[model samples]
Target: MTPQQFLQQKLQSRQYAGSYRKLQVQNNLIDFCSNDYLGFARSLELSEMINAELQNYPTILNGSTGSRLLAGNTIYAEDLEKLIAGFHDAQACLLFNSGYDANLGLLSSLPQRGDTVIHDELAHASIIDGIRLSHAKRHSFLHNNLHNLEQKLKAAHGNCYVVVESVYSMDGDFAPLTAIAQLVKQYNAVLIVDEAHALGVFNKGLVNQLQLQSAVFARIITFGKALGCHGAVVVGSNDLRQYLINFARSFIYTTAAPIHQLASIKMGYHLLAQSQLIIDELQIKIELYKSLMGDVPQSSKSSGAVQTLIIGGNQPTKHLASNLQQAGFDVRPILSPTVAEGTERLRICLHAHNSTEEITQLTNVIKINLHVK
Candidate 1:
């Protein structure tokens, strides 16, 4: 029962389950698994833009020094919140250290003791964790199934909140937001959309892209993935903003992100706004990938940066990923219980910088490995 012994047993259990994860250093292989959809992570022009923006704040405070509730709230923080709010066309925006924190704080704080939180079964782990931390009763609808969600909402007793991802991270599919939004209204439930995978892929996100901003109750937008920066923002009403400030423990307890991180987020938005040609190129690459993947087992056909090729089983999926890596691709395997046992996959991320040749080569390699066309 010693703590060290307990930790060791858990690690052993993970190893046995074929889901143990470890940190990996970057390799110079052709990119296929990273979330850097817009290639902003490797954009030298973006780095220079951020550096130039930081120069305006010559006396930059390296860190926020404390939580937003305490010493962390700076003019920069306030301004950034406003800037983000304006960009997202929301009443208010509250910053969190990460997308995880944003979802954690929003779900944990907003839902009350009697409130019911019904989320998609395939929603991100952060949403699940946040729900676990809350006192609200939880239910999970089938992924992107409006009928199932309606049934859940119909039976719910208290304030109901429907949670979904704009673009699901695993299967790389979109939630039926327009349909879901209508359902939420019909059921008198609030809708919370996690736009983590939607930002750079769909201008601002599906909410903004489809003009569903006013329809959604709240949105969680992160900079790390598509923006290729750090931190996240929760877009909602002014009242919700104030409530989360006072009640969201994750936001209240965590140290604010550094000044440089905030500057990077701002610059990232600037780059995204001005990168039409780059974005168009990414779309072209994605189309090329889809056209080339004639016989590939695509989990979903929703158009976005992420695509999952379902390769069943842990060992087999891992082997395929390893083979792809050895063949000079950076693909990674998604093992169970991260995904269902029979649905383990190789998650591929198409980037703006990925050439048509790389896309064709990647698809061919996958076809050859998987014995497809």
Candidate 2:
């Protein structure tokens, strides 16, 4: 067989072996699988704000014509950064195209050569990829294990950067930030927290709510998930922000986020403040879901908004998610390659708009469809 044919044949085997992936759009189901945590994405209030901003800025162009350094540095990006900085109580902020780009830009550029980056073993792909792009030494500790991380930190390493996510995306678990921050202080290392999954859900990310900023080096905030908009912001010292503008290749090379997107983020923040309905509703749903799910089995450490069911294979995870969809819930599987071989799962995403009845329905549907009983 030709080389290409051989490759495709092996790829087919990968699927049969339970790790292949293909996207499917499942419609007509109650959502248990979207990142629209705060219901802001569908809010008429946010859309109207965007419309109003565009109307006011008559001469402002649609696209950020070039990278931020070139032509993309619009007035809106600058203002939005300032707004975020003030809101999050940080000295300065740098906006990236998205959470992925933000992670790529910062993790790839900072923690220079001779520096050590000790990250959570279960950190999102973006975090790992960003570290891969860096010239620093990288290591991963057991997920949320402070002692494990402490041991690694004690081993050979130069100036260390302790990295973790506020709300882990895959398992929906949280890092022990206070302990991690204290350890970071003892080690005299820099602490960086990624608040990607925690932003609007926990309010301004875990770092802000817990008052961990003074102990950490930087906090990564993504507007896409909780803010329910586009783009991300890195909040830290002014020098760090300036350094990213100068050295982060992702920021230097990519086109700046469009003006409307930035405006939408700004609008979303205001909406979050004006009415706590969406966030409160989400908390209620979360509490209800957790109560019904019965302590999350301790075995399932990752059961936040992004819960992992750990059903054991791509086909099983996919099959279970499909069955749930048929039962009127939009659950999606995190297939093998995305996770470890035996840890594929139905990555359920809980939303603020998800009603109590919907939550109960999904829970019943999932357990039954997966034949857990």
Candidate 3:
């Protein structure tokens, strides 16, 4: 078959599955579907802080000239890594351009030949991809099923790494971290927690929040979501950081994050350091959103920023999301194969800046559209 025909077949398959995705422009809808949990993404104070931090540098460099191992390694970048490591209570921190790169770098490089890499079935795509890239044996436990994880751990053949997200992105649910930690300890398996969605929302993440830093072998934190910035960091022991610098292809081969992005990351952390009020406001809004929904099936058990409303079929889920958007709420449908076919959902991301009235209206419209009332 011709190349065009081959691509057409793939596109048709996606269309038939009702999961064809397309680019969408940002709209002026009432916000209910973004990761800016603390409103730092739109913070005037944050913008000003970035500007002020920019002025501190001796020279204005538009880009990181090379990889961190090469010309890209700067005193500023290394200083920020030190600050991040201290803030996260890690021995060392290594930066990546995004969470995808961090996960890809960590998972792909750490699990060696004959090692076993078991992750949650619902782990992020990047994690799964990284596992695929490794020479290790890989398996997945049922999502958040600790018993399944234990079984997998028992049967693991070699050195094992157990992976999970502290807060699962699509489902807006959390892993049973403390229980998982116990399992990891019992099995003598290394644990890796991706706190991409949990960082700003949970102060430092579930690991830091629960003082489980010592329990986990490594943690991946990202700035793109709740931190309202760009980039990610893998926080672990100094040895692991050094190893990643030497071996992680994604990190070793790519250009470093620009100075301005690093500035945003640094300033974002400074804000998080003093953001008890913002976090409190966010908790209040989360409660408000839940109470306003009033028996609407919530996908998240924790008071995290993400919430999912399950709609079984792709067409129905998309239709509901479109209805909510038409009513001025920016609700997005999480369709298969992004999620499973029967578990497609409308992913609602509550924010600190979202008003009670807006939340109420959004839920009421959802109820009216779905005939829930």
Q: Which prediction has the highest TM-score against the true structure?
A: 3
TM-score of 1: 0.97
What is the TM-score of each predicted model, taking all chains together? 0.97, 0.94, 0.98
> Candidate 1's C-alpha lDDT?
0.90
Regions of model 3 farther than 4 Å from truth: 298-301
Q: Please provide, for model 2 over 1-373, each residue's C-alpha lDDT reduced to its tens digit, 9 standing for 90 to 100.
A: 9999999999999867777666676577787888988878888878888899789888888788998888788777888889999988899999998889999999999977888999999988888999999989999999999889989889837789988998878889898899999998888888999988887887767788888878888988898887878889889999999999989998899998888888898888888776566667778788778776663452253435666677776777778877888888888888767787888877778888888889888877766654544
Q: lDDT tens digits, residues 118-218, model 3?
A: 99999999999999999999999999998899999999978999999999999888989999999999998999999999998889898998889999999
Better of 1 and 2 by lDDT: 1
lDDT-better candidate, 1 vs 3: 3
The best-first sequence of candidates by TM-score reads 3, 1, 2
- Candidates' lDDT values, in order? 0.90, 0.83, 0.91
Query: Candidate 1: where are CA atoms >4 Å away?
Result: 298-300
- Pairs of residues clashing in candidate 2: 171-302, 172-304
